[model samples]
Target: MAGRQGGHHIACTGLSAFPLTPMRDDAVDERAFAAQVARVAASGVDSIGALGSTGVYPYLSRAERARVARVTVEHADGVPVIVGVGSLRTSHVLEHVDDAVEAGAAAVLLPAMSYHPLTDDDVIGLVETVAAHSPAPVIVYDNPGTTHITFTQELYARVARVPGVVSIKIPGVPTEPAAAREHVATIRGAVSEDVTIGVSGDPFATAGLAAGCDAWYSVIAGTVPEVAVRLARPALAGNAAEADAENARLAPLWQLFTEMGGSIRVIAAIAELLGIAEQPCLPLPIRGLDGEQRRRVAAVLETLDHAAEPDRDE
Candidate 1:
């Protein structure tokens, strides 16, 4: 459920689905992207993360990103949209933030999108700068894999103090229950009580939520949202056994994520397979999954065919 802080509605808690910014040829497939947004919004997820890493944030141009943000908010159908506004240059990130707010974003996810080695202070400064100017609340995105910027507990604490920061999207957490709890507990101690902690890295989602994360910033939720919701609803509701059972059921898919590299390509493959987006929908250079790999994804999908079926339980 979403919580209100003072006046701002913080929709950072629960499952926040991240949809692909589907592309056709070299340009953004606005129609396809909007459909993805509409699909996720209709899934009853708590929020929609428009342009996180799963959405291929770095590859898109400012204009494309602005259009994607506009399309996401417009199609989200009142679902809170958290647009990612991370860029190489701080100024450009702020500009993206402006575009996102203009497009009706409820919050912004700012990763330390770095090319050069960035000091901790540099990252903190970037957050402070954007938070001061951004009309929407900020989500400190600690995505070390893409950003190559590992945020220490101290770094998280320092940035969470920024006036407008409302959430922190941690990359992942420990798989073991005790370890995951300790890990999330340390970060929880560092931020404000109201600053929601959302877990990325879909495979670790149940563990993270079980360990006390406020949300699941899910990649798989973008393509096969009903399945994601199946797990997330139980997990967020404190149904540990049901959540763990669902996690075990999706073990094949999670293993595929590792075997295939990461969620980006696998999810793109799923979207294409489901006819939710076009073939070769991802931006160029990232050819998505190859034919053989796609076949494997297809096989996996067959086993999880229930994903495409309606959630009659709902």
Candidate 2:
């Protein structure tokens, strides 16, 4: 947090777009994956988050993830790339971090991915070990929904003290503006000022940023970057009202996320409808939104397309 890590500040602030790792025929679709990286890079996002939860990091093999990190750096057009390195085992996580850094990743997103419950010491040890071994900076990822490990403020303070730790990606902020601001402030106070706090939970990206979180670690941005960027620009500019307006504009998109149960399927559905990926792009047994669900997703996309608005960039 004292800036000792010295990597790009994208880990701390700005919009880091998480692009999907598309699959086809039960294989990692390198072509589709490359295209996704290139598309996110083209959008002028602050950074490219490769192999994130949105990118299905835990679903792929180490070799596949290494290849993905390479593809992401190659297609990122010089945009910094943060690779996810989370696994059930510490040994595997270390291996993934090495592979990611060797593949030219700018930073590594480390989460305590566990099949068994993890103690605070276990998670802390994981962070310390990675920070010690990997040259790439570490972004602590706190995703209780998927990883089943919630981070306490005390944990944040402890991890932020690790030499190479640069960012902490927290879950959604409170819906109420005052509460959201307080939530972000408490975390900010826990860590050194150099450590950036990023907000995940796509629906609350705007509020998180507006409340003073420096970065938006976004999932939906992986599919529709322009919309996410539109919201971020204003929020980062300190124009909270404008950012909220933009978020309000994507009400249908957010509704779809809640209705479809989660972001992955809905995003995969959007990717297919946009022709960025083929149907069944997700890994096996996880068949993406199908038939009627897909139709509903399509209608949402169509509405978004029909009502598209211009951002300042335009």
- As for candidate 1, its clashing pairs are none
Please report, in order, the local distance difference test score of every candidate based on alpha carbons: 0.87, 0.85
Off by over 4 Å in 2: 1-11, 305-314
- Residue-wise C-alpha lDDT for candidate 1, range 58-138, written one tens digit per residue: 999999999999898889888888899999999999999999888888888899989998999999899999888888888
Candidate 1 C-alpha error for residue 67, in Å: 0.8
Give all TM-scores, in the order shown. Answer: 0.94, 0.94
lDDT for 8 (candidate 2): 42
lDDT of 2 by residue, 74-116 (tens): 8888888899999998889899988887878888999889888
Leading candidate by lDDT? 1
Off by over 4 Å in 1: 1-8, 305-314
